[model samples]
Target chain A: MRIIDVHTHPVFMRRGLQRTEIDWLVAHGRALGIERMVTLGDVLLHGRFPTGEQISAINDVTAQVQSWYPDYFVSFCFLNPTLGERHVMSEVERCVTKYGFKGLKLEICNNASDACMKPVMEAARRWNLVVLQHSWSMTNIKQRSFHTDPADTALLARRHPDVKIIMAHLTGCGVRGVLEAKGLPNLYIDTSGGLPDEGLIEYAVEHLGVDHVLYGSDLPGRAATVAIQRVVGARLTPAERKKILYDNSARLLQLN
Target chain B: MLCDVNAFLGSWPFSIVPEYSAPQLADYLAQSGIRRAVVSHLGAVFQPDPMLANRKLLAAVRRTPALAPLPIVNPLLANWREQLTELGANAAVRAVRILPNYHNYALKSRRLDPFMDALAEAKLKLVLTARLEDERHRYFALRVKGVPCKAIAAFLARFPDHHILCTGVPLFDIQNLAEKHANFSSDLSYAENITMMEMLRDKIAPSRLMFGTFAPLVSARAQAAKLTQSPLTAQERKLIYAENARRFFSL
Candidate 1:
């Protein structure tokens, strides 16, 4: 099966930066039938809140890795939205003009529904970039103030209907997350994080159409074979599997 | 062929996982290259008396040779001796599993001393499950945590002669305990990572590592691919996939 991993950290915690390490990751991913990988920067390198320079350093690492294997890896600009419009705008513009970043990556810098995210979504619209937000179920974790819950992502999608958003971690989002993202046309969910729970992929496809679900491994934390087989092994038709495994992401990220 | 050491035959109460019958589970696992599995019934986890569920497990897998029943026992219960006596009578049963967190008993409890002795005398292998579901995403009301690594270390030290198979342990715990104890083996059901085999190469031997699919609850294909797709030699792969399980359980 042809696959596109929509979320990854090839340079996690400042590791995997060597030329040899980058080549091994490409070979490893290609051996599993992965055609392209969206490289999100080493997101928690400086803890939950990172300074502007720190954010640039992280994105620079992603750019450096993508430069080594440009045809194999895709780059995403990691942004901490709480740094206000000046910083967010400057960083997003720098990444877009300098590195050709295709998407904006938001971690636990702030909740998606918070007022600080206004400029982040605004930048996504101006730059014509898709927004990939770090999201999980906040039922057990009480960090909703800064952490983006699936419901908060849905709210962000509703508020900014013009911008497309990809919510990360289906297993972390659970059953309620699917329902929360049911009718939002601008919102998408990626299969990543935690263990691969049975029936969750089917549940997501049932609630949100097959076109809205994306495949991601959150790698170095999860394996590509495991993530691919979760969708491969789901009870979906060949056409649906084709869409989830490769076609949907290819279309959404304009890889075709 | 892969012999999963952690496949389940009953439903998880909190999720939409398939609760497979013996033959159904066997076929489900077979799709992922798992030809044989050491099976346990989830019904035994919550019921006040586990024998009812244990009896069901014994009968259900009686005709299914691909599956071998691993009954769960609650030593804290008064009739644990009788439970062991009855389970030991069945030749199909090669091991007995215990969930200390779910059964409300600590690993250091005085009750397990006699229970360990009974297991030693009976010659049935012991399987310790550290956690069934991830504690963070488990049912909101179920407030149980995984058995601590320190507790497992103490138990291994306490019974220095017995060899135990531990399921659902994370990679870090497996490494932590491996440095101190040599009497335990861990399943890769929960030890997930991109280069998992490479990470374990320095810390643990292939004989101490085994394949496991937390099936029906977790995806068997996903868990199997974690091992089958990892970087391991043919010999190391054989040891992890089936040979180690055969020598460990005498299958």
Candidate 2:
């Protein structure tokens, strides 16, 4: 089965940044049938609120990985919207024009519902790039001020219907997250983070449909084989499994 | 033939996972290549009297040969000896499980010393559950945390003669506990990383690691694949998948 992981941080905590490490990761992923991976950059290396230069350094690492294995990786430009519109727009433009980043990666710099997201979403709309937001339930974690809850991501999608959005971490989002993403056609949930809780993939598919559920592994922190198996191991038809593992991501990112 | 050491029967109120009958659970596990499982009742985790849940669990799996019943014993209960006696009387029962966090007792509590002695005298194995669900995703009202690693390490030291099997232990904790203590074995229900089994094999012997799915709360197939798709030697795979569990439980 051909698989495309929609979320991964190949260069985590300064690891996997070298050519040798990248080669090992690419080979490891391919061995488990991953045809391609979306490199979300070291989004947290500089902490939650990184300066503009720090953000560029992180994106540069992602660009370097894409440079080595252009065929194997799809780069996403990591952004901290709290850096404001001028910083956000310029970084998006730089990543897209120079590095050919395919999407925008948002971590816990600010809530998805904040007013600062306006320019960030505008850059995505202007560039026709997908936006992947880091999200969790926030019911217990209680860092909703900066952490993007599933409800907050859902609201982001609701506000900007034209911009494509991917809510990362299906297990972290749980049942409430699925319902928050129920009606919004623009929002997608990545099956990444937390334990591969039983019946969650099935539950997501049941509520949001297979098209809205994409395969992801939050890799380096998670196993690509385990993440792929979470979808394959589900009690879904082979066709549904194929969509999540391959086709849905292909369609979302316009990958051939 | 994978023998899951961490499988559960009944519903978890926080999850939407379907409640399975013993036959149904057996069939579900069989579909994912789990030949046999050591299962405990989920009802016991929340109930005031675990014996009521234990009786229901015994009755549930009595007819299913594929599942070996592991009854949950609340050691803090005044009638824990009675619980152990009744569970020991059953020829099919191999081990008794304890949920220290949910049962509102610390692993270091003196209550467990006598309880461990009873298990030792009864010739029954002890299955200590570190956690059943991820605390980050649990219900807001359920504030219970996983059994602490220090408490677990202390417990291992306290019971030097007994070999304890711990379920739902994280990967890092497994490494820490394995380095300091040799008296404990763990199931890979909650242990995960890019090369999870390979990493664990480097830290702990393959013989000390057993396969567990934490099913009905976590996916059986996904948890099994944590080993099945891992870069493990055929010997390592054999030990973790069945041999270790068989020897641990004497199944």
Candidate 3:
């Protein structure tokens, strides 16, 4: 089956930046039937609160990866929304204009409910780019001040209905995350993060519908093979599996 | 054939995971290409008396040959010996799993020494569960943490003779423990990454690593795919999939 992984960090902790390493990763992903991989830059390279220059360095590396395998890789401009509107706007424009980033990737720099996200969402809306936010159930992590919980991401989607939001980490968000995303056409959840727990994918599809659920592996930190199998192994019909595995993401990102 | 060392047979109260009957579970696991599994009763994790749950597990899998019962024994309980005796007598029982965190005992506890001694005498293996589910996603009320690696290391050092199989241990913990101790092995139920098996092979000996699906709570197919889909050598695959489990459990 043709698969498009909607969430992945090909360049992590200063690794996979080399041409040979990128080649190996591309080959490895293709071997498992991944046609295209969405590269979320090393978002945590400079820690939670990276300076503007640090953000550029990370995106530069991401842009470099896209440069090498333009056909097989799609880039996302990683942004720390807390960096304020100036940093956020300029970086989004730089990545989109130079690297042709297809989306805006937000990590744990600020909670999705924070006021600072307005400008970030505006940039996504202005550029017509998808916004992929790193999210989990903040019930346990307790870092909701900066960590974007599923509820917070849901709120972000509600506040900005125009921009498409991909709440990353379906397993981390759990059942509550799926319910939070219900009826919100602008919000989607990526099947990434944590273990491929039994029944979660089915639950997500049942609650959020197959079209709103996308396949993601959180790759380098997770396996594409296992992530693909998580959706394939779900009790959904082949058509439903095809949408999650390739069609939904392909259509959402306009990769076709 | 693959032997899963971390599957369960009861309902997880926090989630809507299927509460499968023994035959049903066997069929489900078989669909994931698991020929055999060492299963523990989820009921035992919370019950004051694990024997009741153990009995249920035994009765449920009595006719199912594909499943080998790994009864949970809470060493904190006074009747642990009786529980061990009852479990060890059964030819189908290869190992007894212990949930230290859920049972409210540290791995470094003096209570485990006597229990380890008894296990040695009975010729039954020990499967120490580092965790059952990811701590981040657990129910809000259930505050159990995974068995700490330091405590696990202390246990390994205290009992060098016992070759323990630790299920649900994270990859970093396995790497740390494998570098310092050789008396322990781990199942890959919780170890994940793009290069999961390849990275584990770099740190721990292939013989020390085994296949575990943590099924019912986790997808057996996805966990098995962690091994089946990885770029592992035939020898590594053989060792992880069956040989290691067979030799360790004496199946």
Candidate 4:
């Protein structure tokens, strides 16, 4: 099966950044039938709220990974929207122009519903870039102050209907998250993060349609084999599996 | 062939996880390359007495050969001996599973001492389920946490002779137990990491690890893919896939 991982960090917390390590990841991913990987920078290296320079350094490492294996990896610009609109706009423009970043990655810098996200959404609109937001169910984590729950992400999509958004982590978001992203045509979900719980992939496809779901591995933190297998093993039809595994991500990112 | 150490037969009260009958579950496992499984009834999870549900599981899987009935036994109940007696007599039960968090008993409780003795005497294995469902996304009203690590350590220290099989233990918790105790083996039902088999091999031996998909609740293909496509050797793969379970459960 051809695969495209929509979420990943080739350089994770000072690990997997070396040339040999990067090559190992590329070769390993290629062997697992992964055609391409979207490299989201190590967003947690400096903890939740990173400085502008730190965010740039994170994106630089992501760019480096892409440069090393241009055919295998796609870079995404990591931004902390809490750093105001100027920082968000400048970084998005720099990464897109300098590194050819295809998407904007949002970590837990601030909740997706906060006013700070306005600048982030504006950058996405101006650049015509898909926004990949890190989200999870907030019932247990209790970090809603900075964390973006699935509902918060849905609200962001509802507010900005023009910009395409890919909500990361289907397992973490659970069944309710799929339903929340149901009606929004501009919103999509990636099947990454947490344990590959049964029935969740099929549940998402049933509620949100096959085209709205994308494949992701959250690599370095998660295994490519397990993440891809989750989609492969879902109770989905052949066409649905094909969309989640390859076509949907290819079409979403406009990957050649 | 994969032997699913963790699977259920009835509907979970709070989950959208599909409930399957014995034959249906067998077919599901077959699609995931699982030839056999040890299954319990979800009805036993919430019912005041697990005996009714246990009997139901026994009757349901009677003709289904692929699914071996592993009934949940609540030692905290007053009629513990009768429950054990009934399970031992009718079903070809090799092991009895216990959910401490669901049954409202700590692993360190005094009652488990006799319960352990009874299992040893009965020649039935014990499967300690640390957690059935992830605590975070569960129903808000179901306020139960996993059995504590220290309690599991104490339980292992308490019963050195019984080689317990622990299901749903996290990867970190498995490492913690391996650091202190050597009397138990664990299933990789809830354990996950980037290079899981590589990391586990560095910390613990292959003999102590077994394949578990937590079927119907966890994706069997995802869990199996972890082993099927792992970087581990053929020998290590055999251990995780079936040989270890065969030796551990004497299947």
Candidate 5:
């Protein structure tokens, strides 16, 4: 079956930059039935809070990866929402206008429910772009001040209601994350990050509906084949598998 | 044959993972091309005395020859030597796993010296479980953490004669241990990355890294794909998938 990974960081920490590295990655992905991948940009390249220039540089790496194989890669503009409206709007405008990025990627910049996210959501609304928020169960991470927890992402979706929001890391978010995403049509969760814990994919599908689930491998930290197989190995029907691995992402990103 | 060094037969209470019976587990592993697995019981991890769960595990997997039972041994327990004696009765159990954090003991505990010596006497292998669930994703009420690398490193230094198969450890931990200790081999359940095999080749040898799937809790198919779908050569794949496990467990 065809697959589209909605979350990935193709060039992480200066790796996957060489021609050989990119070729091998694309080949590995293709062999595992990944026809397209959405690059989230190396958002943490500049650490939790990067300067405006550093954020731009990170997105540039994504743009370069997309250019290498435009047909296979979809770019997302990585943003530091804590940078306030002007900086947030400026970066989103530059990345979207210049690179035709299809989405906005939010890492541990600020909690998704924070006031500064106003500009980030506004930019998404303006560009008609998807917002993929990095979310985990901050019950232990204890960095909710800058980190986006599932509850915070749910609040962001409820707050916006108009913009599409994808909560990242189903494993990190766990059962509570799935429940947090339930009943919110605007909010979705991607299977990415950490170990491929069983029953999470099925739980997300049951609670959030199949359409709201997307396949993602926080690449370089996670593996695509492993991520894909997690969905495949789940107790879902074949149609549910296809929806997660391909249809949902394709529809979300308008990939025909 | 793929020998999964980290397969479980009982349920993890925190999640919805199926509690597999021996035959059901055998079928589950077979679906992922695993013909053999070193199995354990989750009851042992949480119970007051692991021997009850261990004996149950031995009986549970009796009909299913594909799964070899690896009983959990709590070294801190008063009857650890007796536990070994009872497990040694079967003579099929090649290894016994220890969950230090779950059992509320330190990997650096001096109790392990006598315990390791006892294991050596029985000719049973040791499987040190660094973790079961990822700490970041564990149940909010569960505060148990992964066994620390420093403790493991010190344990390895103290028990150089015993070749321990460390399961559920991350790839970097395996690399760190490989640099200083030659006696420990790790299962590739928690170590994940893009181009995983290629990344591992730089740090550890093919013989030192074995295949494992924290199945029932983790997807066995996905964990198997970590090796089968990688850049590993057939020889490297063979070693990791089953050869290393066979030699380590004497299967």
Candidate 6:
């Protein structure tokens, strides 16, 4: 089955940047039936809060990966919105104009509800780019000060109304996270992170609808085989599974 | 054929995973390439007395030949002796499982010394479930953690003769314990990484790792797909699939 992983940190930390490492990743992903991967860059390279320069460096690596295998990779500009409007706007403009990035990658620089995220959302709206946010259930990892919980992402989606939002890590978000993203047409949940727990993918599809579910493997930290199998093995219709595995991401990213 | 070591037959209140009876669980496992399994009951997790759940488990798997009954015994409880006696009478049972995390005890507790001795006396293998569900994603109120690797290591040291199979342990913890102790084996239900098999081969022998799906709570097809799609050799695959389990549980 053809697959498109919408959530991935292709340049995680110091890995997957070198030519050989990138080649290895592409070959491995292709072996597991993934035809395309959305490279979200190394979001944690300079820790949770990165400066504008650091953000550009991360996006540069993302652009480089996309340049290497333009057909196989889709780059998303990594942003730290806590840097305020000017910095956020300039970085997004540079990444979009220069590298042709398709989306904006938001990590734990600040909560998705912070006032500073307004300009970042504006940039996504103005550029017609999707926003993939790093969100988990804040019940356990209580770092809501900078972390974006599923509810926070939902709030961002409710506020924006125009920009698309993808909530990363279905397993980390769990059942409650699915409920939080439910009924929001603009919000999507990615199947990534942690052990591939049974019934979660199916539950997400049931609650969030098939169109709002996206395939993700948080590669390097996780394996594509396990992540893809989670969706393939779910008790979903073939069309539903196809949407989660390939078409949903394809439509969200405009991967014609 | 696959033999799952972590299959269960009871409801976990904190999870939305559908509870399966013996026949239902057997059918589920069969669909995932598991022809046989050493099963336990989830009722033992929350109940003050695991004996009731153990009795229900024994009764549930009584007729299902594909599902081998592995009763959960709480050594901390007063009637552990009776629990052992009842399970021992069943010729189909060759092993018993313990969950220190749920039972509110440590693996190093003095209560386990006698428990280990009793299992030895009964000629039953011990299966230590380090955890059942992923603690991070479980019920918001539940805060139980897995039995520490150091504590499990100390228990293995205390009883060097017993070969205990510890299930639901992470890949890193499994590697850590296997480095110091040789009297333990692990199930692959919770073990994962990009290069899982390649990573484990350096620290532990292939024979020490058995295939466990942690079924119902976790996806059997997804768990089994890892082994079925892995790059392990035929001999290593055989060892993980059925040979290792057959030899370990003495089936």
First chain TM-score for all predictions: 0.98, 0.98, 0.98, 0.98, 0.97, 0.97
What is the C-alpha DockQ of each candidate?
A: 0.72, 0.70, 0.80, 0.65, 0.81, 0.58
Question: What TM-score, computed on C-alpha atoms, does each candidate reach?
Answer: 0.98, 0.97, 0.99, 0.96, 0.98, 0.96
- Which portions of model 3 show Cα errors greater than 4 Å? A13-16
Q: Over the full model, what C-alpha lDDT does candidate 1 score relative to the true structure?
A: 0.91
Report how far off residue B123 is in candidate 2 (Å).
Answer: 1.1
How well is each residue in B77-169 modelled by candidate 4, as lDDT tens digits? Answer: 999999888888864788899999999988888998888889888888999999987887767688899998888899999999988899999
lDDT of 3 by residue, B1-251 (tens): 79998888988899879799999999999998999988889999998998899999999989998988889999989989998999888888888999999999888788888899999999988999999999997899899998999999999999999999998899889999999999989999999988777677768899999999889788888888888888789999899999999888877
Off by over 4 Å in 2: A13-16
Candidate 1 stretches greater than 4 Å from native? A13-15
Model 5, runs deviating above 4 Å: A13-16
**True-structure RMSD for candidate 5:** 1.2
Candidate 4 chain A worst ten-residue window by lDDT: A8-17
Q: Per-residue lDDT for B232 in model 6?
A: 91
Judge candidate 1 at residue A111 and give its lDDT: 96
The worst-scoring run of ten residues by lDDT in candidate 6 chain B lies at B131-140
Q: On residues A131-199, what C-alpha lDDT tens digit does candidate 6 reach at each position? A: 999988888767999998889999999999889999999988988889999899999999998878878
The candidate 3 chain B region of ten consecutive residues with least summed lDDT is B194-203
Sort order, DockQ high to low:
5, 3, 1, 2, 4, 6
User: How much of the real interface does each model capture, measured as fnat?
Assistant: 0.75, 0.77, 0.85, 0.72, 0.85, 0.63
lDDT of 2 at B97: 94
Better of 1 and 6 by TM-score: 1
Q: What TM-score, to 2 decimals, does candidate 5 have?
A: 0.98
Per-residue lDDT tens digits of candidate 1, residues B9-116? 877889987678899999999999999998899999999999999999999999999998999999999999999999999998788999999999999999999999
